[model samples]
Target: MTEPPSLKKEPIGRLISYIHRTQQKRLSRSLSEYGIGGGGQYSFLKGILMTPGTTQDQLTCNLKFDKATTARSVKQLEAAGYIERTTDPEDRRSHRLYPTPKALKFQPVLQAILDEGNAKLTRDLTDEEEDQLIALLQKLNLEE
Candidate 1:
């Protein structure tokens, strides 16, 4: 009897990692056009835009980032005039994050870049194929 071909174990992780790295590089290049650098800053900005007035702890949980990294990103964003922190009225000891007008102004540029990236990533895929891919990814997340 003929033997079936064996699948390589390493290719799955390696392929996924390579794809992630390439996407990050592309995103970094896009962000650089707007004077922003680093993945953390982009992530923080996205999170703040999604949940204005979010606290540091809330950001950490939402982004799955550690406290130190989130705090550093927040500090850098604040200094860059992209975000501001206000004391929570209910809890003076805690601060809430909000995007500055400067940051809001960049929303269109950021959204354009994201839309372009999404278009490129799904360029050749049919709607069904895209849906299947998304479903598979969701399944993997559920497994986690």
Candidate 2:
């Protein structure tokens, strides 16, 4: 029997897109309690937390997000009291990012939540399989 069109045409793209959608929905729900929106807002927070004093441009480059998205997420995180932005002395137009005390206090909790989410997402895979899948996905990552 011939393969169905859905399975035959761009199957890899379709499957990856479906997985992305599913991950986004779950991340959105999980992060909603913390006032973090989806579409990698938490990612931005994590980046800032991990690298205090990093500039918005650095976040954009390191996280591979556009300047607008980095700006928007930073604004939201600052409004939520999760982060602080200070003018970079040497570079007047740039701002250095830092996590607020609230963010520092919530860091472990946030990590736990994200860890649980990853565990749930990969529940069906064994440890080795998960590692292999990650390696394979990295190979396909064109963002680099």
Per-residue lDDT of model 2, residues 80-109, tens digit only: 999999999999999999999999998998
Judge candidate 1 against the unseen true structure and give its global Cα lDDT, from 0 to 1.
0.85
Q: Candidates' lDDT values, in order?
A: 0.85, 0.91
Candidate 1 segments exceeding 4 Å error: 1-10, 142-144
lDDT of 1 by residue, 1-144 (tens): 989999867775677788778877888888886766775678888889889999999999888888999989899888888899999999999999999999999878777887887778888999999899888877765223
Best by TM-score: 2
Give candidates' CA RMSD values in order: 3.1, 3.2
